[model samples]
Target: MLKELDLARREAEVSSLAQAEQDELAELREWLAAPEGAKDEHRRIAGLRAEVKEWQETYKKEKASWMRAICELTKQRDLQVSRADLFAKQLGQWRDIFQETDLTNLEQEWDPESSFYANEDAERRECQP
Candidate 1:
């Protein structure tokens, strides 16, 4: 009687273990068959992120180049404006110097008395009929 009871208990334990293994295998198969795109989604998201990073880098470089060009152009424009102002100031100074010289007064001060009749008048008077 004892031998028979021990054999039956061992057989039940084996059957339960086999059933548990089958359940575990069935759960694994169901998980594999489900439509989960986690791996693919991860790859796609990573690709999109890389593209965004590249675009951002390109934009930054272009922006920096544009800023540099603007700065250089501004400097050139300022230099041109400064040169024009200096030229105008020099022209004003020259005008002031010419005004001070007063050429009209000089001409009047050096006028000759009977300026056009000195030798000519003497010759005409000596040859009068």
Candidate 2:
């Protein structure tokens, strides 16, 4: 009887140890199936990277369009400045010519009753038809 009792006790201890090991294995498997923190952080990082790439592409396209518009406006402004400079030069030439002329002594140069106007009037009336 004593020997039988000792064997039964030993068997029970072994069974308990086996149960503990099985529990630990099941816990480890559950932990592996659902991790603590790293996977979620990795997903978030990947999403952020995609968003950044999209923003960079948008910025590049907008920057290129703005640069093209600036170039076109700059060309138009340069053309306008050149035309204004040409007009200024012509006005200066006309001013110089008019400044050198004597307008106060105009009656001594020509007369209204001269044959020049009489002949010019006659030719103008004839050409009107």
Best by lDDT: 2
TM-score attained by model 1? 0.52
Candidate 1 colliding pairs, count: 0
Model 2 C-alpha lDDT per residue in residues 14-112, reported as the tens digit of each score: 896698688657755655676668556655755785697689669867976886798799999999999999999999999999999989878777776
Q: After superposition, how far is residue 43 of candidate 2 from its true place, in Å?
A: 2.1
Tens-digit lDDT string for candidate 1 (71-118): 799999999999999999999999999988868777767646556767
Error of 1 at 68 (Å): 0.7
Q: Which window of 10 residues has the lowest lDDT sum in candidate 2?
A: 27-36
Query: What's the lDDT of the predicted structure labeled candidate 2?
Result: 0.78
- lDDT measured at residue 21 in model 1 versus the true structure, 0 to 100: 82
